[model samples]
Target: MVRAGFYLLAIMGFSVSGALGADAVERAVASCWACHGAGAAPKDPTMPIIQGQQAAYLEKQLDAFRSGKREDQIMSSMAESIPARENARAAAMIAALAWPKVAGAATAPAPDSAIACQSCHGADFTGGPGPEGVAPRLAGQFAQYLEARMGAFSRGEIASAATMTAMMKALDADERAKLAKYLSGL
Candidate 1:
């Protein structure tokens, strides 16, 4: 009905914009807003909030997706949609947008194991430089996305961080869930 029409309009708009000579980086970022939401939280709980994420982290992920190191079919395509030379520019653009202020469940007390994460993710869980590299912000991220990523790391499905893989593998699923819940409420 109306929802379907909106989608059609959006798709057509994208096509028209590209055909009208919108640059690759602008097109790539516009496509991100389709799923990631424009300056707001995504509707799907499983999708991560990319706005205001560390530019370095975003750039690394885009490269990983483009190189086949990361394995989401849709993301692979999205990453590829950006010209290889414009990956950093696209990441910077996305990172420059404000992070959405999402209200959710109340914050819980931090798990003891969560301390280890603070060294990289910042004491506030807003993310910072780590020994490994730039850690992405965990505070206010979706619990479902966090939990899924933790599980992926545990299973060695995400190849970006061996440290994360080893750390996640040490924790049981329950522990990871607890961590995700705690982080999301911040």
Candidate 2:
């Protein structure tokens, strides 16, 4: 009730703190920074950098976790704790930040296995439009993290996105690793 009311107040241009005040909402979202990191960068390579992600994508993923459509025990519990109405607010704040970049990241030529990925992930592998939804930028992400995620998709551990699972499963471990290495370096 309070969350919605506050948003309503902000929307009405009666924001208490300032013209763009969101201190209360930011406080509520503080827990997200625990695993995601104090800054836009994730502390762990395995953790996806949520900053600068498309707002629609973030909102969709959050809703999926909250609704159990996506099976992430950690994220599900976290999502549950937030009032349903706050999901949009949280997504908006996170998505508005800058995307993290890896300085001097290794770059490699795209392997044959990565050809199909470009159709969605973009020619630069930064991300692009697709039939399903917006693909995330994988250019500066960690190779180990990408490999692990591909492995999870192949094993159905991450079943929230079916296309990824299918694509990961189509390639053997070596191919996936090669693609991950190539994509991560860019």
Candidate 3:
């Protein structure tokens, strides 16, 4: 009887642990999909597609937002409520999703703008590596989303002194729109 009771208790304990783990993962994923899924695409032109981003990069950005180190109203609010460990789990899940191919006609950038952007965003505008912690992938983003974000930085709506912002400031409105359209179709 004693041995049987011990085994039963062990089983129950494991069951409870398993359930909790599953719940944690589910909650984290739901929170992320709430904003990133097709339904949540902000009507504005600036929100980037988060559907199939690199998990490591996503996790880093989430951490930055949570820590109040990154600036964006929506991201800050969302990240603020997530615990660090859970954020990491969410990031992993997002990263696991397959990247979507960009659709529609590709817009071309002016030669000057193309030269300025090619170094970090890649010749194709798919993001490439730079010094550690320097760049994020820009390809496959929605044009409206990209445009809105660049406009925000240009208007001081989003707050990051990062090189991207500097680059944004250099572009005229037409260039920004062209790049956004071009990237979305990549």
Tens-place lDDT digits, model 1, residues 1-186: 999999999999999976654476787789888788777899888778999999999999999989988878999999999987888888888888898977555687788899999888999988878998999999989989999999999999877778999999999999999999999899
Clashes in predicted model 3: 6
Cα lDDT tens digits for candidate 3, 62-116: 8878877777788887876665577777776766666655444365545357567
Q: Single out the weakest 10-residue window by summed lDDT for candidate 1.
A: 17-26
Measured with C-alpha atoms, the lDDT of residue 79 in candidate 1 is 94
How many clashes show up in model 2?
Answer: 0
lDDT to native, each model = 0.88, 0.77, 0.68
Off by over 4 Å in 2: 1-24, 159-162
lDDT of 2 by residue, 94-128 (tens): 87888776555677777887878888778877675
**Better candidate number, 2 or 3, judged by lDDT:** 2
Q: For candidate 1, what is the lDDT?
A: 0.88
Best-first order by lDDT:
1, 2, 3
Measured by lDDT, the strongest candidate is 1
- Give the range where candidate 3 is weakest over 10 consecutive residues by summed lDDT: 38-47
Every model's Cα RMSD, please? 10.4, 5.8, 4.0
